[model samples]
Target: MKEMILMTPGPTMVPEEVKKVAGAQPLHHRTEEFYELFSNLNKNLKEIFKTKNEVITLTSSGTGGMEAVIANLFSTGDKVLVASIGYFGERFYDIAKAYGLDAELQDFGWGNAVDPNVLEDKLRNGNYKALLVTHNETSTGVTNNVKEIAKIADRYGVAVIVDAVSSLGGIPLEMDEWGIDAVITCSQKCLMSPPGLSFVALSERAWKMAETSNLPKYYFNLKKAREGVLKPNPDTPATPAVSTIMAVAKATNMLLEFGLDNVYKRQATYGKRVREYVKSLGLELLPEEDIASDLITAIKVPEKYKASEIINHMKEKHGVLITGGQGPLKGKIIRIGHMGYVTEEMLTKTLEALKDAIKE
Candidate 1:
């Protein structure tokens, strides 16, 4: 079999150490051994999230984490503003509306970042219970200025809910320092783990909202998850993904060992390398440099080339896997993910494959 490289934004290439843990014998979730692992997992997760808040783990997709936050923190008829820049941002809006929140979407263009000034104006003028923002707009490869946006929300006394699914572990996000009430992320992206686990951290203010929230929820109940984590023997409300959790526990430790700052700088370096090489090939990046994400790069596919055709060629001819745009930009742009355990050598090979694919 040909060696295949995954350069897509999610389910990123896993480190060998994490894969080793995942391959270990599955432990019973109710055992003391698992509890000890769970305890350590939660502690490391808090450090990555940069918050002192109790981080809740759920055995579901990142979207489930988003839903958990919306369902637990707000009631029906609660008005909230969703600052949408790309696909994931729009998902936050969709989730909010699905739960019967009066969701007002403050939409910016796909490849652009949310202007804090505009967000502040909305907060000052609009009647909102909370503000929902995507820390990284993965679709457009744009990273929002969460620190600035959080400051604006804080000034207006509006609760802030951040969808940090693609940004939390890959980048620096000081949730407590930014005054964000809640932030949700998954294990697959920068956490260097596989799918099936999503994490949500709640500040003191978010916990207060959960206490008063009248929204009906059962499986994704934050309170229950919190209680489970706080017990003498840590566990989950449902049978969690035992093996996946074990893998994530290992991945988290590896990330800390490398040092968070070093990880961020490494990802930045990879992104820059990809961007410069792609531009040298006469390709245009989707997002402006100021708002570009260090974890993913979205580039406009040349007009004559179909994104799908190029993607197919790259896979079949070179055994390299990348992704095309989502939503409206589909077939118009290609997204190259540099997050997780990706290396410069891997990216160099991907670029070579891309150049070959384009030529052929």
Candidate 2:
């Protein structure tokens, strides 16, 4: 039997150990055993988020975390400055609008990172109650300088909400030290786990925002979630995805055991190797070198070639599944993912397959 390699940005390859947990018999969310698992998961989540604040787990995809941030941290008519560079950053703008918030977007080019100087100017001049940004723009393979942006936002006394969906465990971010108010991530990207769980962490300032936010929400209500989790037993506000939570528990343990710094180093090294190998094939990168993400690499397709040609050929002929570009980039580029359980051997094979596919 041949193995299928996932080279997409997410719903990334899961580890066998984590898969084993997800495949196990389901447990009731109310049980003592489940509480213990949930507790340990939250503890590890705080470490992964690099925050001392309580990390909340929701039984939804990464978007749920982003939505939760908007739902709980700001009221309707309250203004937010969305620093948008790519698809996911645009998503932040969309989310804000969906909630009836006054969202002013600072649009950078799709293939570039957000300029901190530009962000600083906006924060200093705008009357925004919050600054929303994506830590990693998965669509463009660009990573923003959240630490610097947070510093600038902090100086302006604006709350910083970050979408760390694809970068959290694979990249380095310090939520507490950098004064990030809200951070969002998911199980499928860098956690080496299957999809269906999203994590949200809030700083003290963010919690304070939640206290006054009047945005209408139910399942994604962060205040309700905090109330439940802050209890002595600590539980989710809703009936949790028991199996997925168990799987994430195993995955987070594995990441911690590997050491967070070492895990980040591995992902960065793999990302660099992918970039170098793709460039050697005369492929150009979408993002600037300084802003390129350490979890995924977006390569521009040659003028005469279609991204689907290489992507479909690799999947059909070699069982290597990489993804094509999104939104405006569809058919113009291909993205190679190096996060989670992706290995060097798999990347080498993927590169070889891509090379052959391109020649065809």
Best by lDDT: 1
In angstroms, the error of model 2 at 322 is 0.8
Give candidate 1's TM-score: 0.98
Candidate 1, lDDT over the whole model: 0.92
Residue 218 of model 2 has an lDDT of 94
Model 1, position 85: C-alpha lDDT score:
97
Indicate the worst ten consecutive residues by lDDT in candidate 1: 2-11
- Over 112-169, each residue of candidate 2 has an lDDT whose tens digit, in order, gives 9888788888898997899999998889899999998988988989999999999998
Candidate 1 lDDT score at position 281: 88
Q: What TM-score against the true fold does each predicted structure earn?
A: 0.98, 0.98
Instruction: Quote the lDDT for 253 in model 2.
Output: 95
Which residue window of length 10 is worst by lDDT in model 2? 223-232
Off by over 4 Å in 2: none
Local distance difference test, each candidate: 0.92, 0.89
Clashing pairs in 1: none
